[model samples]
Target chain A: MRHGKYRFLLGALTLPLALYGLLVLWPYLQAFYLAFTDWTGVTSEVNLIGIDNFTRMWSDPLFLAALRHNGLMLLAVPLAVIVVALGLAAGTRGTRVYRVVYFFPQLLSVAIIAVLWQFVYTPNSGLLNGLLTGLGLDSWRHSWLAEPDLALWCVIAVLIWSAIGFYVVLFAAAMESVPADIMEAAAIDGAGELTVFRRITLPLIWDSVQVAWIYLGILALDGFALVQIMTVGPGGPDNSTEVMGLTLYRTAFTYSKFGYASAMGVAIFFLSLTLAVLMLKFTRREKVELA
Target chain B: MKTIRHTVLTLWALVFTVPLLWAFMSSVKTDAEIFDSPWQPPATPHFENWSRAWEQASIGRYLGNTVIVVGGSLTLTMLLGALVAYCLARYEFPGNRTIYYTLVAGMLFPVFLALVPLFFVVKQLGMLNTYHGLILVYTAYALPFTVFFLHGFFRALPGAVAEAAFIDGASHAGVFWRVMLPMARPGMVSIGIFNFLGLWNQYLLPKALNTDPDDYVITQGLAALATSRGASSDWSGLFAGLVIAILPVLIAYVFFQRQIRAGLTAGAVR
Candidate 1:
């Protein structure tokens, strides 16, 4: 058995490691190098250019717009998702995790969600207008995804709608783990629901909410699928809804400027890393010990 | 309080659930009806929309392709992920922590950072439009989440059973294959179901790597259906295609709600 032990260990580790290296690690390293070079994605001849792409990115309006949109989502979507998900999850302790609300959107492909919402936002004969017309609120009708000012918000709405259910369940699970006696004691002290939530429920489930912040923050930064498939011009109604992921994709694939796209990808990587670290730093709290 | 809560929950349910119900309902409405009366029940249910989307729009072929690739990759991810987790968990060998952290670190970086090189890597291998290529890459990318999630599960298992198996002259591989593997079924099933949903809905990898039209997976095919001719004249059929894409996942969620939820919220658990 000892003789075969080393062989078994080596055998087990080899394939997964090799696959990981070839597909994940190698490409990641190459992406950094390619970000600094001029690889047209069609040409075999590559030459290092030394941060030219990064310098160009600061001046490029499209990349800046994409960065700003990601930042906006970074602020807006996580707050909305956390607020709504926590509201829905409040007091629903031990609720079974089978809500169709989450599964419907969470399980479906982005393509489906995009197409579904496209019809919903269609200006003339779409669901939103039809609902408005039915409610005699004809003054409210507009092309939801076509209006530049309204388009990013529309995408953010979908992002929040699709995301809230999972966190609701996650927070509810956390709430369940909070001892019944603590909640009961809070209630016995004549605390209102809001007060109890603020003083007790919030701190007890602070860890889960923090996890949610980081997850939703990263998710907000990667709205490629929603923005790509749903928005007008695929990235525009004046580029209002363009995101970093879509920018990287279009920069690479549409323009075939792989090196430039690689630069955008690296920028996104550092942005997310910073976002994660910031969330961890700012959201840190003194541990709440239950008596 | 209960009344208010129920009211909010009910309204919340309607807000989120109605769109899917509407998508399914609209799938059966004529294109004109869908346009004219978005909220009404269809005047006449167009049962043929499903068939049209399945046959003329080629959603059937794409679904078949998705099943093959997702199925192939899920199996490989589970087997390899479990093996890696087991070896790392149960043994102390050189480079163990390094390999574990290396695999776990794969999760932190966004896939977009790797997309450019990964595309060329596959292209250089002459596997740009191949099933095996996508399957291998899918397994490779999925390794991180699987190993990370299963690592804790493997660590928690009792050591006595494997010890007893070893005393009975079971080879190390035999003890793992027989004793440890069966004990890890719950973890495997949870992650497996989650992996299925994720890989099933995967659009980025396929959209980037597999551009050949003949190899469209579910998301790619449905995306094409939206952009091209079917989107203009055949709205109901497009809705049908959307429903067909989502229905299997909804069904799976109903049955495996426990495991699926566990898989999704596992990171939040610890």
Candidate 2:
């Protein structure tokens, strides 16, 4: 019976495992190796140039710029998302109607969202500028996407707009799980609303908040597709919104430097892995002490 | 406090819906009207704009392509995902924990990490820009979450039901196909909607692996329309393409708002 059971287990797992390994894991392993080599994607030859690509990255201005943008987003996106999502989740009354509307952005593809927002940010006929001009605040309108100082912030705004609803629902779900009586009790005890939220609601949902930080952090790191379709140069006027994924992508396909691009991928991989572990460790330690 | 909350929520909802509403309205305006009166209702709704985007822009072609690819990938993902998830959930064997963790670990990998080599991989298989190639890649990419979600579902099912099926002389395979699979139907439907939306909305995969215009998916096609310089003057047509791309998702979200919400949030909250 045990033998037959093992047979069924192995038999069932074989095909899915093989597909996942071949298509996902194998390539990831190869990327780590490829990072060390100098293989122009066009070439049949792969020369192992150890750490050269990694060393070169520090001197590359574009790579440094990309890293700076990603880092800024890694800090800004999650903080902004949590604030708005937490507010909405805590404040909203009719969740049914609100959830549907708020989550609408999550339904559309990044491509569709990019295209839609591109129109919204259009200089002359755009929704933002049109509304501003209509309101007699004409000077407030600068080319939202075209201006170098503001372009990356514009991209960040879109990212925040698209992401907030999901986290709102996430935080709301966590909030809902807290006993209603606890909140009621806090109110009856002369606790202010802010005090109750801070002393009570916030503590209960800290875990979800932690998870959200990691999720949104990773998302912030990969602003590739959104930045690609949204910006004029994609990375754009003065490279203000250049991201790590975009840098890696252009390196491989546009410049055909597969090895150097693989090194960028490896860097992103480490960044992501570190973020995940660090969040878990940081949050888990506090989680235990809270209990 | 109550009034303040209501006011804030109302204002935020406007922020969410107004851009979409504006986009749909702009879709029907003449190109000149789009530039001149961006916020006004069109004098007459140009319904032909939708048809033009559908046929001329070949959004219809791209829609067809998306449906086929999403359908194929969704089916494969569920089948393979269910089988493996069910096993990991129920069976105990050597390396069971290892296999389960390894699959779940794939979720943490940003798809960007794999793109440079993943492109080469699909090309090596001579499968780039082809339907099956994309279907396979999508399935592989989707496995981690699908398995992760369905594993929870399978684990939550009572052990007694499967034990009864076995006593009735159902073989392992028979039990899984007939008894276990049906029992996991709710989980299937949840993750099914989850995967459907995900695979449907996929941008980077198709953008990276399939660039041929004929092979372009919805995202690629609409993106091409949006970015292509020749179509720059056709703002009405471009907005029409945007609205067309949005409508199906909008409709599905309306109909399946409950399942969609529950399906999407289940992983995060759990």
Candidate 3:
């Protein structure tokens, strides 16, 4: 415990510490500085612009749309992942066959998921359209990913479908980890399955739920690949599905506005960090009864 | 009630797996067959799609790149994480708690926040498209959970033994590397599986950093294949690429599911 004895321990930890500083902390600090500059990615000159980037972001319609898209995605994806995953988790608790089938999709990469759904939503030639025509509901089929008004929701739906399996498995594990004694007590008290879930299971796995929420928030902010692949760069038919990452991608790559992209990146970083911290604060260890 | 429950579960599972099933079926179909009977299985199993995808899409090169990045990242991360974890677990240094908490905070920071500046940092380091650059970044990003997970594991080790080693005048690094790390094999395995799976499966960072075909990781290469003109509608080739991309993760899950699941839930469960 003495300083002299701990020197070797400090030496062993130094490399990782330095790497973290250089790669994560330094970049994080640089991103904050870059946010105040006006450096297009293509140029070397970066002039100080103060809070202009942040100020412009506030009134920027595209930025607002991106935020709205994020809100919608967070609303839709997590809700779907939660509700359906819980349902599947409950139903497949004792079914080996169902568990394998449900968890199979989690094996696919997000790129593959995006591509597969892109085909499935390929306007007129898509499987959905074919099925619609076959069912004599041809008019009900629309340009799913090509319509400005509906593309964002459509992308959100695909994300929901792709993400639900992973969460289902996570929730199932959490639910199974709940001690059996409390469940039996609830059951003895005339609690049905739903009643037991509400009173006993949910409270027990509250930490897992909080973790899942934080994970989902980060996923919402970082999910640019799906928009990039499915929306083909404009985010959607009219940039409707442009979330923070996609906007950052556009600013950095498309517009070559390195400074602006860095600023957006910082915004996303703080947004997610604040949201995660708030979630953890609310779902503190004290909130769980552990009874 | 039993039959109804079985039926509902079966239906839900089947519905959920449709995309995966569709991808598999499409992977073996000819292009004409893909467009003509999109939902049907191939009349003739086109195994050539895999070969073609591997050859034309340059998946082999991408896989190689991925292996280096993922392997290098996991090695560096585990090395660093285990060391940091040992420091936290065994040593009482100034600001030890602060260091520990800061490491934990890194895991929760979203990747998006670091991407912009991270790109420039890598560029500045002349590691823009190199494996080392990505590996270093991955090690940093991956260190938080690695340390967090390994800290619990190291603390779980009996401190009396470490004290005995200290009494014998074993250097701190000697105790950590020679004694502690060997004792924490299970913890190391769990951390390895988690980090390997994560680094292998990462998409955005590779895509953002590496723009050229030669430097591309599997995820980025697969995306490129899917988006290219001749490549876009080639469902079979795309499926083939998907198969290649998911194979390692699937193998890992099959072999090390317990460790991975344990590692994944470590942060949340605690």
The backbone clash count of each candidate, in order, is 0, 0, 0
What is the TM-score of chain A, computed separately for every candidate? 0.95, 0.94, 0.88
Q: Compute the DockQ of candidate 2.
A: 0.76
TM-score of chain A of 3: 0.88
Candidate 3 on A1-291: residue-level lDDT in tens?
433565676577788988888888777777888889998754559899999999988898888889988977776676677778877777777665565556656656677678777777876446777667878997899988888888887788777777776777778887887888988988999999999888777777776777777777667665687888777555867778888788887788778888888888778877887878876886676566553
Candidates 2 and 3 compared: the better one by lDDT is 2
Q: Going through the candidates in order, what is chain B's TM-score? A: 0.96, 0.96, 0.92
- How would you encode candidate 3's per-residue C-alpha lDDT over B1-270 as one tens digit per residue? 788988888778766766556666777788878778667778889989988888887887889998899889988888889988988987776889998998787765667667778887788789888888888888889898889888988999987877888788876777787889999998898778667767877888888887778998887887777777453456677777777676667676677665566665554555
lDDT of 2 at B84: 97
* CAPRI category for model 3: medium
TM-score to true structure, per model: 0.97, 0.97, 0.92
DockQ of each: 0.70, 0.76, 0.57
- Model 1 clashing residue pairs (backbone): none
TM-score of 1: 0.97
- Residues B78-191 of candidate 1: C-alpha lDDT, one tens digit per residue: 999999999999999889999999999999899999999999999998889999999999999999989998899899999999888888899888988999989999888878
lDDT (tens digit, per residue) of candidate 1 on A1-291: 355899888888899899999999999999999999988965667989999999999999998999999889988999999998888888455444335455456667777788788878888767888889999999999989999999999999888888888888888878877788877898998988899899988999999999999999999999898888888678899999999899899989999899999998899899889989999999999989776
The C-alpha interface RMSD of every prediction is 1.7, 1.4, 2.6
Q: Cα deviation of B13 in candidate 1 (Å)?
A: 0.2
The model with the greatest lDDT is 2
Ordered by lDDT, highest first, the candidates read: 2, 1, 3
